[model samples]
Target: MGKSQLMEKHPTGKVQVRAALLPLVLGAALALSGCIADPQPGPTDGGNAAVSTSAPATGELPTTSAPLETTNASNKAPVYWVGRSNDDFFLYREFRDVPDQENPVTSALRAMMSEEPLDPDFFTPWQNPKELATSISGKNVITVDVSADAFNSNLDADTADRAIQQLVFTATAAGASAGLIDSNQQLQVVVLVDGHTGYLGFDHIRLGAPMSRSTGMVAPVWIIDPQEGTELPEGVVKINGRSTSPGNKLRWRILRVEGNSDKTSYLSGEVTASADPSQSGIFALSVNLGPGKYELRVSRILSTQGDSEVNVDSRGFVVR
Candidate 1:
C-alpha cells in the first residue's frame, strides 16, 4: 500500500513499515496491492539484501497441462526469484487438500481477499499452483483450487506476496485468463480448512485470482517491557522480541548509546539478526548508561540495501 520508510539498493537494505501505515492503505476494501520504492540500485544476487523490495515478472506457463492431483513434495514452480540475497528461490508447498472446495486455508485467503482485496498476497496457495487451473468455457468462473501445502505456510504477509505474484504471473500467462481483478467468477482460489475462521478452518473455502501486495509499515519489532533505557530488573536483563514479517527478513541493531540528542557517538557496537538469532531477535544492550542523560539509538538493517533509521522508539527508563 505504501513504500517502505527507508529503501536501499540491496533489498540488501532495510525498510521500516509501522503498524500505523497498514490501516490507511488497507482501508475497507481488501484487494491485491504492489510496492515500488525510489528504486535504489545494488547487487543482483545475495541472500541478505538491505533495501527490502519486491518485484513481479511474467513467467512462462508450461504447455500440455496435467491433472490437478495431490502430492507431498516441495513442488515449487519455476520463478525467477530476482534480487541479490535471499530473494533468489521461491517455495511452492504442495498440500494434500484442494483449494476450490471446502478448506481452512482457502477460507482465510478468500475472506482476506474479498474483505481486504487490496492485500490478497497475504497467503500462498498449494504447490504447482498453475497446474490446478479450471476453465468454465462459457462461464466466467476460474476456481483456484489450492492444496494443503499452502495452508502449512506460516510465512508472514510480506513473504507471502512474493509467492503469490509468482503464481498469479504464471497462471495469467497460461490460458486461465478468465481470472483477474474484475469479474465475479473471474478468479476463484480455493483450499482445505478445519471449518473455523483461523488458518486451520472447520471445513474449507475458496478464493478467486489476483492476490494483493500490500506492504505497509508493519510492527517489525516489539521492545519488551521495562523499555529500552530501563535498567536490570534481573541482573541479567533478557532481551527478546516476538517477530513476524513478510520477507522472512526483518532485522534491528543497537548502534551504541548516543552521547546526546545530536545523534553522534565516539564509539559504537553492531549486531545483526543473521549473526545471532537469539541476540538479533531483540535489540538488547546490557551496557550501563552511567549517570548521565543518553539516548538509545536503534538501526533497521535490511539485507544489503538500505540507509535510514526506519524507527527510533526509544525511551528514558532508569537503571536504579
Candidate 2:
C-alpha cells in the first residue's frame, strides 16, 4: 500500500500533520507502577554496596505512606513541560510550589509561559502569552483565554503543534494533580483568543475543539524520579519513572561519566527493573554508588521494530 497521510488544514493556510502512533515497544522505557519505599539496604560506606537487583515475587509494589505522602518533595503540584530532542518534542514534568488548593492548572500554564525550563535540553516555543486566563467550564473542560500576541509565528508547523500540545498536557496534568478531576473521567482543554474560541494556535492549528492527549504525542520514556542535578547525602538512591511499553521488566544501567571524555565506567550491568502490569506506574530500583558524578540510563529494545534502542531515559546526578 502507498504511504498513509494524516493531515489537517486550517481555514487560513497552515497544515497540521498528525504523526502516526508508533507501535508499543515491549519493555520500553520506565514503566512506573509501584510506590517508592525508603532507600533499601545498600553500602553507604566507602565500600561498593551491591544495589538490590531482585524484583519481589509479588507483582504488587510495596505500599507505604499515604497517597498524599507519595507526592514528591512536599505537596507541590506537578506541571508538565516540553523538551525537544532533535526535531521531536517530548513531555517532561516539574513541580511548582503552588498550593494544592490553588488552581494549579492555571498556575502551571502561567509558569510554562513565564519561567525557563530547568532541563537544558527542553525549550518552549512560547513568548509569554500575554494576559493568560484559565478556567474550567461545564464538567471537565479547561478553557484558556489569551491575546493574539501569544500566537507568535516564529515556529514551524511541527514545533507549533507540540507547543499547543504542551498547553493541553500541562493543563490536564495540573488538574489531575490538584484533585480537580478524576482519573476515571475525561479532561479536555480549549484555547480562546480574546474571549473567542476560534483562535489559531502558534502554527495555525484551529483551537476551537477540546483537545485530548493521544498516544502518538508523548515521549516513549521519562525519568520521573531523582530530579536532575539532585545532590544525595547517601550513596543509595531510589529511581522512579513512567513508560508506555507493556512488559514485565525494563533494563537500567548506571555509569560514571568521565569528565570531558567519551569514556564511562559501568557500575551496573544490564539490570532489570520491575514494572507495574498496568503499563504506566511507579517502577523503582535501589542503587548504591560512591560519591561522584554519574549518569543513569534506562532503556529497552523495540519489540515492534528491529532490535535497537527505541525508548530511553538518561539522568545525570552527583553523590556527595
Candidate 3:
C-alpha cells in the first residue's frame, strides 16, 4: 500500500511541474510573436528623404503627410545673445520642427504614437518611406527585425504614443492623403532591452503604436508568398506587395528599378510598412512578359540599400 501511494505521488509532482511551466511556455510564444511583426513605407530616388512635403497647411481638409517631430530641451522664448538693446533677439524654434517621417530610426520614434484607436483614414500612416531594422526576426513566414535604440532615443512609452498622434494630426491638417497604406499589410512593434529581446510588459515601450491607459500590446504580421524575387512561371507572373513586419500593411510597388542607368524608363511602385520596419519589405511586379533580352528591375520605394541607378539582371527564356 505504501509503495503504491509513493508512485502516485511521483506522478502528481510531475504534473505540478508541467502545470507551472504551461504559462511560461505560453508567455514565451506570445513574446516572440511580437518581435516577428513586419511592414513599413518608402523607397524612392529622392536622396535621403528627410522631411515629407505631404503635410497640410496650418488648417486644411487633411493630407497624407504629417508635420516633422522635434525635441525641445527648454520651454523659454526669446532665446537671444547679449542684446545691444532689447531688440537684438535670437530665433526660437519649436520643440519639434520637422517631422520624423523619413528615417527608419525616426519612423520607429514617431510610431510610438497611435497606441489607441486612431482615425483610420487620416495621415501617411507609417513614419518613413524606408525602414531601419535589422535582418530577420520573422513570424510565420514574414520576416523582419528593427533596432531598439531607435525607439529609446526618441521617447518613453508614455510619451511615444502622443508623438505618433502629433504626426497624424500634422499630416492630416492640409487634408490627409489616401492610398498610402494598402489592405494587405500587417504590423508589429518590438521593443528590445539592452540589445536582447526583452519582455513586452509595461517594463519598456513598444516599437509601434500606443494603446489604452491600461491595455498595452502591439500589432504583428507575416508575408507568405512571392519571397523576395522568387521567380514565377513564364506567362503568368503574380506580383504583389506585403509587410513581413507585423506593422507594415501598406501597398507595395516597384520603386523604379535599382542601378539601371542604361534603361531610361520608370518602373516604380509604392510600399508601406505596417508592423515591421519598411526597409525589410520587398516590392516587386510580375507580368506575362515573354522571355527576351529584358532587364529585371529590383525596385525599392524608400530605401538607400542598393546603387542609385536602376539595376537590371539580364535574363532570357521562352514563354511557350
- Return the lDDT, model 1, position 134: 32
In candidate 2, what are the lDDT values of residues 170-283, reduced to their tens digit?
Answer: 787777766666645667788888888766677458887888764445555667777767777655777776545434344566666566745464554343334444334446
| Top TM-score prediction, candidate number | 2
Flag regions of model 3 displaced more than 4 Å.
1-228, 242-261, 264-286, 292-320
lDDT of 2 at 154: 48
User: In order, what is each prediction's RMSD in angstroms?
Assistant: 18.8, 7.9, 24.0
Instruction: Provide the lowest-lDDT 10-residue window in model 1.
Output: 78-87
Ranking, TM-score, top scorer first: 2, 1, 3
Q: How do all the candidates rank in terms of lDDT, highest first?
A: 2, 1, 3
Looking at model 1, residue 73 earns an lDDT score of 36
Q: 191-247 in candidate 1: lDDT tens per residue?
A: 212222234321232234333222221233333333434544312223333222222
lDDT of 3 at 200: 40
lDDT of each prediction vs. the true structure?
A: 0.28, 0.59, 0.24
- Report the C-alpha lDDT of model 3 over 3-42, residue by residue, as the tens digit: 1211122332220100111010101011101111111232
Residue 9 alpha-carbon offset, candidate 1, angstroms: 42
RMSD of 2: 7.9
